[model samples]
Target: MTTHYLTKLLRYRAWADQLTYGAVAALPEGAAEATRATIFGNMLGTLSHTYVVDDIFQAHLQGRSHGYTSRKMPEPLALNELWLRQQAMNDWYLAYAQALSPAQAAEEVSFQFIGGGDGRMSREEMILHVVNHATYHRGFVAEMFYQVPAKPPATDLPVFLRDVSQP
Candidate 1:
């Protein structure tokens, strides 16, 4: 994939994440931390999982150990703290993508999965995975919003492209 496309994807990822976090934070007190029927436990839990996974892939792209044993964090971060960490990771991803040349984007990297297996992906593929993974979990967060009987932010890619990202 082209560096231009990679940069755009990361930008889209960051935009959607910001909107998701805002929606969660806007929920009534205790709503974000309330236990839910989902696997991650609650809204915060689901978002934290995405952050952890993003961190794991960040380490993979850097060719370093992520030092994470699982996709989920042991302790869920509060909404404010989680947003800070997520913002940093999102910034790192954007910088990394913006710096990639065509050759660098296509370069293959190998890493061990948190699930215990060898894994390999091109830099472009890994970036795609990170963006896609966050989008997938944001769906979970959006679902939890319904449990709150509240409206979630419109984080759809087309919305981002039309309203946020410029041509």
Candidate 2:
């Protein structure tokens, strides 16, 4: 994939994340923390899982240990705290993507999976995974929004492309 396309994807990811977090934060007290059928327990848990994965990938990109034994974070952060951390992570990704050269993006990185196994992917592939993974979990968060009888923000890539794309 071209760096231009990847950078746009990263920007779209950040935009979607902001909208998702905003919708969750606006929910009534206990709404975000409500028990759900999702694997991560609740909305916060689901989002936290995405954050942990992002952290893990960030370390992998840097060729260092991520210190995460599992994708699940034992203690989920409060909505505000999670948003803050996610924003920082999002910014890091944007900067990283912006700085990535064509060769760097194509270079394969090998790392140990948190679930125990060898894994490898190109740097661009890793970035794509991070963005795609978060998008997948945000669907879970959107599902939880209905439990609150609330409408989640439109976070589809098309929406981002149409409404937020920059020149």
Candidate 3:
């Protein structure tokens, strides 16, 4: 993809992430930590997992080890802490995308996956994977919100285009 296409996608990713985290943070005490049967176990677990994956892919893009044995976070961060970390990662992605030339964006990076396999993907592919992966988990968070009996913010791409996109 062109830099503009990928930058727009990443920007939307950040916008939607902020909306998701804000909604969760606004919930009553014990809401995020509530018991649940979802993957990662609950809202907090799922959110932390997403950040951990971002860190993994960040390391991959840098050609370094992520130093994690598994995708699961050893301990979940507090909601505010997770929000800060995710925001920082989101900003990093935006800058990374903005700095890439089209040729550079297509350059391939080779790295090992956390689960013990060698892997390679173009810069564009890696970034797309991050965006898609987080979008999937954000859906998880949205479902968890339903369990909490709260309405989640609409984070769909069309919504981003309508509300947060640059003309």
Candidate 4:
């Protein structure tokens, strides 16, 4: 990946992560249970799905089988702990991505997906998928927050551009 593209993606990921973490922290203890029923089955579900998928891909990158049969949803009692775990994993991914060379990014990585034997993708493609996947789910979570009085944080690409364009 070009340095410019990587930088833009990194910034977008950071912003999206911040918004997701903020929304998760703002929920009341009981709200976690109501989350799924209200606003598209709860931000927690979306966040959990995001984390699980990322873990799957990360393990693939590291040449390990992703043992998960299904995406795990965060328990209401352990939502905070799950959020913190996801944050740490995301931080690790960002650091790994930033350190990758352009040549490394273009190189193909081989791995297996559930129900499949082997698969391959360029490192650049994997990084793009991770960012795109997170953005897609983050939008879902953001919509869940729409009915609440507090304005949802902007997760739009143009909004990200505007922030980056600022001096």
Candidate 5:
């Protein structure tokens, strides 16, 4: 896809990330970190994983090491801190996508995955993967909220598109 399209997708991803974080923020204090039976352990665990992966890909696209040895931080960040980090990372993705030339977007970035596998992706593909990967884990966080017996902010792509499409 074109860099222009990539920017739009990144913007959508940022919007959804904000919505998800907002929903988590509105939960009763401590609920985000409350232990649960999910792959990432809890809402905070899942959200931290998203941030970690986003940072990893951000470093990849920039041709730098993220300095992260695992898929998540050693200690999960506090929800507010994690939200702020996620915001900055999302902003980075938006700016990075906007700055790409079509050729640069297609440039192959080779890097080592966190799990010890070699990996390569075009800048565009990396952008798409980051967006898709975050969306996937946000689903896990939403499910964690249901265990809290609260509804989450709906973050479907169509919701983002329709919400922003209107005047």
Candidate 6:
């Protein structure tokens, strides 16, 4: 069951990343810099925050402390660079997960949080948390795209499954 869930989550993450990159690519050159939000301050900032959080969680899964200090807004990379990096990270995660056994998934792992405290969780739980975290942020990005003239790609899990099923 855990492996099945992991497979679905991996697929969802890949689909979501592709959708995000597509939306980001369609934006005007300076659109990410211009769009402001109450919490994230801007689209670029929000996306950077999402990336930073993912990095932090990835480090945690590796039993290391998070290195990022602030959610520094990444300079707009070329669409290819952005998409390639996202795809690489997602592929790495899927590979890591596929290598795990049920016993490994149930094992407790420890790592330090960004601020100061040590944290521990089962590998399975951590993987699920990472998926949930990405989903939440992707939803935010999807909302940001809704305000723009060009429609973002459909990010819903069912939509992703349906599209993948067709071909």
Find the candidate with the highest lDDT and give its number.
2
Tell how far residue 43 is off in model 4, in angstroms: 1.4
The TM-score obtained by model 3 is 0.96
Question: Which digits, one per residue and each the tens of the lDDT, describe model 1 over residues 44-158?
Answer: 9999998999899999999888888889998877899999999999999889898888899899999998888899999999999999999999999999899998999989999
- lDDT of candidate 6 over 1-167, digit per residue (tens): 48767867887888887778777777978666566563675555566666676677778778765667664534555446656766777787788788889998888888766666888888888778777777887777767775664576788888877877332
Q: What is the lDDT of candidate 3?
A: 0.90
Per-residue error for 54 in candidate 5, Å, reads 0.7
> Model 6 — which ten-residue stretch has the worst lDDT?
70-79
Tens digits of per-residue lDDT, candidate 4, 1-167, equal: 68568657866787778767776677655454354544336777777777887888888667687788765643433577777877787776778777788888888898766665778998778878888988988877766666453456777888878875332
lDDT of each: 0.91, 0.92, 0.90, 0.72, 0.88, 0.72
Q: Mind giving the per-residue lDDT tens digits that candidate 5 earns over 1-167? A: 98767877888888898889999989998898889999888998998998888888989988887899899788867888998998999998889888888899999989998889899899899999999999999899888888998998889988978887332
Collision pairs in model 2: none
Cα shift from native, residue 143, model 3 (Å): 0.6
Candidate 5 clashes between residue pairs 3 or more apart in a chain or in different chains: none
How well does candidate 1 match the true structure in TM-score terms?
Answer: 0.97
- TM-score of candidate 2 to 2 decimals: 0.98
* Model 3 Cα lDDT, one tens digit per residue, 1-167: 88888989999999999999999989888989998879888899999999999999999887787888889887778999989999999999889988988888899999887877888899999999999999999999999998989999999999999877995
Off by over 4 Å in 1: none
User: Model 4, stretches more than 4 Å misplaced?
Assistant: 35-40, 73-77, 115-118, 147-150, 164-167
Error of 2 at 65 (Å): 0.4
- TM-scores of all predicted structures: 0.97, 0.98, 0.96, 0.81, 0.96, 0.84
Residue 152 of model 1, lDDT score: 92
lDDT agreement of model 1 with the native = 0.91
For model 6, how many clashes? 0
